[model samples]
Target: MPIVLYHFPLSPPCRTALCTAKALGLDVTIKIVNLLAKEHLNEDYVKMNPEHTIPSLDDNGLIIWHSHAIATYLVSKYGKDDSLYPVDPAKRVVVDQRLYFDATTLFPRLRATTFPLMFLGKTDVEPDKKAAIYEALGILEKYLEPTGWVAGDHVTVADIACAVTTATLQAMGVVLDAYPKIREWLERCNSTIPHFEEANKEALKDVAELIKSKVTHNVYAP
Candidate 1:
């Protein structure tokens, strides 16, 4: 059976796993879980992942949830190149640690600062959220360099994982103009991975419309 990847595009965690899958040349049957339907919060999905979240991998009937865990599992099991996930124990440890930080720390902060305005349709708080976004971006700025990737010289799965989240957050209208390194890194990641863009083909339009609708409605309405 083909591996099944459960995901919701709007979710950063789901995108992380998807990015890793793309990077590794894995043939996955994507099951777009409906987060909007609260399907993730429902009992059936909860059985697959008690946390009730996505970017989960179902491999020949075995389920692995949590985006970081799923991505690590894929790399450990099926990565085509060592650069995608280094075999060196120390390098792997550093990359895995960063993956955890990106998954639990950076991603949550980005969400806290953007999701309320973007997904929740809450426009009145955009200015405040934008400030929070800059703060979180500054955190990311500290780790980023002109090195062309995150975590190392080679574009590891860590870069794929973090880039997907950062790209989505930027797509949500969190300004990245000040973070030139991040912008360059994003382009580098896209150029390196052919499948990341394919999997996210519809995301740009949706995010653009969502941001525009909220901003326009908020600005014009009395």
Candidate 2:
């Protein structure tokens, strides 16, 4: 059987795994999982991923969850070269830092804002949550100043992971007024990354519509 990806289209993290597979040029069968419906909580799914996260990858018999881990596995096992994940220790750690920042800082902020809006019908993000997201983006801007991409000069899983989050934030009405570098990098990502549009085509639209229904204004400036 081909590699099976348990995915939810609206998830930013799932987009990372899908983008990595596209970049690696691997054929993966995507089986949609509804997080809103508690599909990930199913016994079969929890057995494969105790965390029950969206975007679990079953590569043959090796079941992997968490977008960052799944992405690293696919890249390490199948990448023709180490470009997406450099082999050098120093370079790898830089990429690792950006990946971790995305997981801990960038995406978490997005989740913080969106969860309440999507589930609890909150119209405005709490002030501290807005501040946290912009703080993460400010650091990201400086990271990109040294190199066009987040990890380094070239796109890596770090950029792929963070791009989805930032792009979703944009769709959710977070203006990029202060983060010109991030704006440019995101533009470059859309053009340079393979299957980038296909990777996020519907998710962005869905996010826009969903967010539009919840909030009347765009936010997070400077």
Candidate 3:
């Protein structure tokens, strides 16, 4: 059976899974879920993804909702080789760490910063929220300094996952001068990753414009 993906173009998680599938050369039927219209809360979509998040993949009968999991599944089942997700246990562990870093550390900050501006009508990013995002960027910089990639020397699923998060944060007006390694790594990802622009650029611009309409101040500004 063919894969069917439930996606929102502006969502980082959706872009992550979409880019992963593209890199693996997998054909997927895209179904747009309009968050503004609450389409993700519909009965069937929620049945497929209990959390009701974007980028749920229905691979035949198996359902994967989370982007990291979707990426892993696509690579394991269809990839010609395991480069995107290494077969070696030691190597896989590093990729796992970076994935969680994106999920637990990186993604939450995006939600925290955006939720208020988008949903609660907050005009400025709270100081703590702004600081939290920079802190994650600092941690990512430390990770990238050694190998120029988040997980290992090669671009793995880890980089794909983090790239969308980092790029989205940048488009939302996060300053990068303090995190030079991340800036350089993002450039490298743009150059190397297949379908990077197709998955991220236009969606990122949309996110930035949406947020710009709400936020009166750039939190990272002095």
Stretch of 10 with least lDDT, candidate 3? 213-222
Query: Considering TM-score, which of the candidate structures 1 and 3 is the better prediction for this target?
Result: 3
Taken over the whole model, the C-alpha lDDT of each candidate is 0.75, 0.89, 0.90
TM-score on alpha carbons, each prediction: 0.87, 0.96, 0.97
**Tens digits of per-residue lDDT for model 2, 79-175:** 9999999999999999999999999999998999889988887888888998888888899899999879988779999999999899988888788
RMSD per model, one decimal: 3.3, 1.3, 1.1
Candidate 2 runs further than 4 Å off: 219-222
The RMSD (Cα, Å) of candidate 2 is 1.3
Ranking by TM-score: 3, 2, 1
Off by over 4 Å in 3: 220-222
**Tens-digit per-residue lDDT, 1-222, candidate 1:** 999998888777887788788777788998888876777787878888898878688999999998888988898899766777788998888788778878677787666755566567766544555565566667667667645567777778788778877887767666677888888888877787868877665875676576676664432111
lDDT for each residue of candidate 3 in 1-222, tens digit (9 for 90 to 100): 889998999889999999999998888999999887889999988877889888899988888888999999999999999999999999999999999999999999989978888878788887888888888888999999889999999999999999999999988888888788988899989989988877788999998899888866675452
**Which parts of model 1 are misplaced by more than 4 Å?**
118-121, 126-129, 217-222
lDDT of 3 at 185: 90
Question: For model 1, where is the 10-residue window of minimal lDDT?
Answer: 213-222
Considering summed lDDT, which 10 consecutive residues are worst modelled in model 2? 213-222
Instruction: Tell how far residue 144 is off in model 1, in angstroms.
Output: 2.6
